[model samples]
Target: MQKKLVLGTAVAAVLAAGTFGAVSANASAPAAAPAAVVKADAGSDNLFRTNHLTIDAATDAAEAVLDAAEKENQRVSVAVVDRNGNTLVTLRGDGAGPQSYESAVKKAFTAVSWNAP
Candidate 1:
């Protein structure tokens, strides 16, 4: 029993020492360097400029749709999206259906994606 206890204690000490050494070695190691940021050149062929509608222009377009719907005695929602299919303006006219908001946005996105009216 005594021999067994002594052998077990020695094994435990060895494992503990190995764990501590590994931890200390890792702690002393240098940290990884940060990644460098590369800026794209203004005239780079990989990057192209895209024109999108301004907020004022998008809002005006949405308002025009709403006005036309109102003149036709129709309650509706209007949405204006940019060339990237990003919704810029959404107008829910009076008494418009609850689902009209999402529908209008989808319609605008579809139009922008297809580049159609």
Candidate 2:
């Protein structure tokens, strides 16, 4: 189970890196015609759009992690954090160690800080 967890984490990290790399590569390309442009609200010029997971999406992500761990008979804690490293959702699975909760939050924060999985 531990091996599987480690392998899965590694795979996810690799995939995330690849995805970010692709995005960066495309960013340098010449801009194409806009598909659709929505005018921003007045006085919004100082603010740039940013994407973050919704509450329900974050909860679903945490639940998915818990479910995967449970399938491996592993007690674990799952946490989802926003781009700013704020906790969005946390789940301490049955029989999870007390320390697991904090650890999960820290891990989630680190992932967010690095913009990696």
Candidate 3:
């Protein structure tokens, strides 16, 4: 019958289209670009910028520590250190002398080297 033939043709078209669609979908997508590998140059100890301060900044820190100690009525020596073990500033109270300076520097250096306060 004509109806059967038409139905057969319609079914065939649909099956053909489905097959095409499935094949296209399963096809591999374009390969992604390779990931970049950043290599660090040797002999450069700087992971980032260096940390250094001027004398004024160091003096200011000492002054602040001295003022805070005065307000708290505590006699102690204080030393501020850079990110490195280098001493930035140092302040000693009336009772603290040469020994206090050495002690404060040692404490600051220890803190810097250990990465702890």
Number of the predicted model whose lDDT against the real structure is largest = 2
Model 1 alpha-carbon drift over 4 Å, by segment: 1-50
Per-residue lDDT of 34 in model 1:
17
Candidate 2, residues 1-117, lDDT tens digits: the string is: 323323333322222221101111101101221112234566887655434445555555555566556666667766656557787677787888787777777766676577663
Model 3, span 4-110: residue lDDT tens:
32222222211111110111111111113111233355567753432244445445445545555556554556665655656655666676545656666675566
Structure candidate 1, residue pairs in collision:
none
TM-score of 2: 0.60
lDDT of 1 by residue, 6-111 (tens): 2222222111111101111101101121112344677887864433344554454455555555666666666655446666667777888787777766655665
lDDT of all predictions: 0.46, 0.49, 0.43
Sort by lDDT, top down from the best: 2, 1, 3
Against the true structure, what is each candidate's TM-score? 0.56, 0.60, 0.51
Residues forming the 10-long window of minimal summed lDDT in candidate 3: 20-29
RMSD of every candidate to native, in Å, equals 30.9, 12.7, 34.3
Ranking by TM-score: 2, 1, 3
List runs of model 3 lying over 4 Å from the truth: 1-49
Model 1 TM-score, all chains together: 0.56
Candidate 1 contains a number of clashing pairs equal to: 0
